[model samples]
Target: MTGITISKGATVIMHFSIKLKDGTVADSTKVNNKPAQFQVGDGNLTESFENCLLGLSKGDERTFELGPDEAFGQANPDNIHHLDRTKFTAETPAEEGSIVVFTQPNGAEIPGIVREVVGDSVTVDFNHPLAGQTVTFEVEILNVEGNE
Candidate 1:
């Protein structure tokens, strides 16, 4: 570990910023003064995202562009569902553009965005909000701990 570098099983501490094609920042670790720390090859990050960190060392900065498929992935039509409005009460109205969390049979909580609301029906999209969009990812490696 003379010169630390990011690789499989390595622990990494870094700051990252994700932005859309229109330059709207989707997320950033620097904003809260808290850097992200994770192990390479872990399920915490997408494979493509981890690939971008490979070969990076402390103090190194990089920027890369990822297509929709490589980032959040293309939106699946099956992820869109229409539900009866009766499911939502006055306190939890299914208003357009709002997000709601639904529980799955396996006890997983899935968040869905309300796309449209019509008479007694609501269209909700379970796909990630960043799905189907190109994105720019920037990162600054702060620390790298090899698995040696």
Candidate 2:
């Protein structure tokens, strides 16, 4: 701890756990025995998430509760798409709650969850799984570097 704090330009290493409102952990670096490493201002983290870690130093532990807007964000109705049932194959059945991957015109892959399978239609939601839900973050900073 040489007066280095978490801020823009700093690379931080930490263990983190993401928990749902009901206290169920959705993900955790500790589960894999690997701490996360990322730059302070990197686009990997949302502005609100980064703000919660500002000014912290090595060995700092904190927990934060984020609303939907500050977390995964509210679900967008436009992200829901209805496709023809014929588009799906038996191997990847269009069953509700199943995750499916779709390719964009630019050749990028995107994942969506099946919401419903009606007569000739399959509805999918492309929004993040956590969208529209509040979450809790438990973080323990292990190291911070590059912030002079």
- Model 2 TM-score is 0.94
Highest TM-score scorer: 1
Clashing pairs in 1: none
For residues 1-148, write the lDDT of model 2, one tens digit per residue: 5568898989999999999989999999999899999998879888999999999999899999999999999999999999999888887789999999888999999999999999999999999999999999999999999767
Evaluate candidate 2 by giving its C-alpha RMSD to the native, one decimal: 1.3
Query: Which segments of model 1 are wrong by more than 4 Å?
Result: none
Off by more than 4 A, model 2: none
- Model 1's alpha-carbon lDDT is 0.94
lDDT score, residue 102, model 2? 87
- Candidate lDDT (C-alpha), each: 0.94, 0.93
Q: In model 1, what lDDT does residue 25 have?
A: 98
lDDT of 1 by residue, 19-135 (tens): 999999999999998999999988898999999889999999999999998899999999999999988877667999998988899999999999999899899999999999999
